[model samples]
Target: AQSVTQPDARVTVSEGASLQLRCKYSYSGTPYLFWYVQYPRQGLQLLLKYYSGDPVVQGVNGFEAEFSKSNSSFHLRKASVHWSDSAVYFCVLSGPNAYKVIFGKGTHLHVLP
Candidate 1:
């Protein structure tokens, strides 16, 4: 079984500041990693995903994530954040079974001006 863990339940960052949201996953075999953001009264939007090839993958809205097999982690990073970027981020893990996936509790991001 695969699972995702977001250690931080909430994170706060200033506008235009760099941000890093930590995410750790546990799986025996190869796993698919994904970062999704949920805005107020909206469905989850895909931020980025890591399936294969490059360890670091770029995503929408200047978001990027790095896959570390050794560390069993897939962390999301943004060079500079905006107040509008404030939302809940979820780290997800999926195995070969695409239908089945595990989601983290989610980290609420508060961007300060």
Candidate 2:
């Protein structure tokens, strides 16, 4: 079975500061990793995904992550953050079939003014 674990339940960052949201996965076969964000009062949006190819994958709003098979980790990162970035972030994983992804509870992000 495949699953995801987001170690940080919540994260806070000052505007224009760097941010990192930790995530780990457990899977035996092929792993499809993804980072998703939900803005205040909004639905979840895909940040990035990794299946094959480059270890580091980029996403919208200057978000990026690196896939580490050995560590079994895929962590989301951002060079800078904004107030609008204050939202809930989720790390998800899917098998080769890519059905309903298994998601972490979510990490609540708070961007300070």
Best by TM-score: 1
Candidate 2 backbone clash number:
0
Give a tens-digit lDDT track for model 2, residues 2-96.
67899999898899999999999999887888899988778889999998999999999899999999999999999999898999999999886
- For candidate 2, list the clashing residue pairs, or say none: none
List ranges where model 1 is wrong by over 4 Å: none
Q: Tens-digit lDDT track for model 1 on 1-113? A: 56889999999999999999999999988898899999999999999999899999999999999999999999999999999999999999998887769999999999999
lDDT: worst 10-residue window of model 2: 92-101
Q: Model 1 compared with the native: what TM-score?
A: 0.96
Clashing residue pairs for model 1: none
Cα TM-score per model: 0.96, 0.93
Please identify model 2 stretches exceeding 4 Å from their true place. 98-100
